[model samples]
Target: MKKISIILSAFVLLSSFTVLNTVWTNDDPHSQLGFTVTHLGVADVPGTFNDFDAKVTSSKPDFSDGVFELTAKVGSIDTRVEARDNHLKSADFFDAAKYPELNFKSTSLKKAGKNKYKLTGNLSLHGVTRPVTLNLEYRGSVENPMSKKQTAGFKVTGTIKRSDFNLGSGFPEPMISDEVRIEADGEFVK
Candidate 1:
């Protein structure tokens, strides 16, 4: 009888945890995952990944305990300039044929301000994984009339040095900046 009571208690605890968390899938068509980098120290060249997936699960709307994961196909890079995009996919940069995807998984989310959060995560690019922190802004959540589903919006911004990932080697600062700025505007549905 004691064993049965213990088992029931354990099950209840686990079930409560599951009930508290909400899982949300990103709405791809409405999302934008893009980056910008300096070109020849003159102008900024903007680009985006055409294919990617992101999901977030949290116990609260603020996402203080959120678990976020994102995967982007390196080969789907688009800069609007075919030649430049192809070059970016070659050995000079992402080397999409060798390392097909760039990934990120959040380790922690800390509230910073009214709607801002600091998200720490592991970013894997070019076969190397490094710790990165992104500034996340929660835009708010709404109920969709069409599907009657709950949806949330967020914007994320971060920077990464290409050299840390062993990408775009030998490009001097005068030719290309090592720093890349990443941005994401995403909407997720529950």
Candidate 2:
């Protein structure tokens, strides 16, 4: 009897893990993140980057563990100024001439509340990679107005040190804060 009980326990544990990892993913036109970094200690500048692919898997109607991949085209650095935007794409900051994409990949994810999760991931920018934790909120699943497939979305926010990524070049701390806040709203399908 004890042997049978042990075997049943092991099977249940394995099944739990397996079910928790099942997921669905949706690509771009469904999610995006917009960013803003200060410039010359004078203005709160803004820019946007998009291209989203995220997977959602859960056990209790909430996300358990998932992965996300977003790639921002470096040359699309728009700040409303042609010359300044071009300069930003040059070697000093983004170095768009060389490395042309910023990526984020998840390493761990933990549930915080009923519809919130704390996600730990590595953000790669301009060749520098750093860990960032994003606080995410589930926007709930919905029936697509046109497509008939189920769509779910989440909002996530996090901050990172710019100096760690060689992004704060030519600016003093008093002028531009080293911390950059990233906000993203991403939707996925299951």
Candidate 3:
């Protein structure tokens, strides 16, 4: 009976730890992953990856211990201009046929200020993986009236050099600026 009691106690403790973590998934239609790059050192062109998903897991109510993961389909790149979008997916750019996904998995989340955090993660794109840091703003959480679920909002912004990832290597800096600014606004539901 003593052995049974000890086993039960250990199981309860492990279960409680599991209960502390809440997993949140993207509210797909309400989320967007977009980017912008300067063209000809004069004009800024913006684009988006329409097919993407994000998952966040946290053990704290304030999300101070959040772990975020995201995956985006490279073929979903859209810049409004079909020709430009196609070119970006070809071998000259993302090479979507060879590397079909862009992925990010956070390694750390540090509080920078009230409702703001510095998120560092490994981003894999176009067959290259690199560590990147992004500014994360926690827009707070709310109870969704329609779904009756807890929803959390977040906006992440950052900039990465395309050359580091070997993206658009053939394009000169004058024609297509190497810097790419990334922004992702997402609503996640628990």
Candidate 4:
């Protein structure tokens, strides 16, 4: 009886330290995934993927052990210009019909500074997969007045080379910049 009581106490103590992982999904109406590229070495053309989803899973309050995942529909790219948007979706660029989606799954999330983290992940775009590092900023969590649930905000920013992904191979740097800037901001809810 003494041995059985001791075993039960140990199990209860161990279970107290076990943290349940929480999954936070993006609040779609408040999230945006956007990109910018320099055009003709002068003007910057901005675009966005209107249809995308992102989620983070973590067992800790600080999200230090969080795993992030995202998926965006290529066909939903919008640059605010019909002709330009259509061209970007064509064979010369993204070829949305062939590569219908962009995906990202984070491998690591390391704290860099106060509220900042280095997020390294595999970004699959245009049928190519490449490792990319992005800057992640945790904007804190708050209770929503409307939903009354906890919500956390985050912003991710990064730059990728079009040449690395074989995107727009025919367009030279003189006409279209090789570097693309990525930005994503979202509020996630449990």
C-alpha RMSD for every candidate? 2.8, 4.9, 1.9, 1.9
- Writing each residue's lDDT as its tens digit, candidate 1 over 56-117 gives 99887677788999999999999999999999999998999999999999998888999999
lDDT of each: 0.92, 0.75, 0.96, 0.96
- In Å, residue 39's CA in model 2 sits off its true spot by 4.4
Poorly placed runs, candidate 3 (over 4 Å): 1-19
The lDDT of model 2 is 0.75
**Cα deviation of 112 in candidate 2 (Å)?**
1.9
* lDDT string, candidate 3, 1-190, tens digits: 9999999999998987775788999998999999999999999999999999899999888999999999999999999999999999999999999999999999999999999999999999999999999999999999999999999999999999999999998997989989999999999999
Residue-level lDDT of model 4, residues 1-190, one tens digit each, is: 9999999999999999998999999999999999999999999999999999999999988888999999999999999999998999999999999999999999999999998999999999999999999999999999999999899999999999999989999999969999999999999999
Candidate 1's C-alpha runs over 4 A off are 1-19
Worst 10 residues of 2 by lDDT: 50-59
Better candidate by lDDT, 2 or 3? 3
* Candidate 1 residue pairs in backbone clash: none
Q: Global lDDT for candidate 3? A: 0.96
Cand. 1 TM to true fold: 0.90
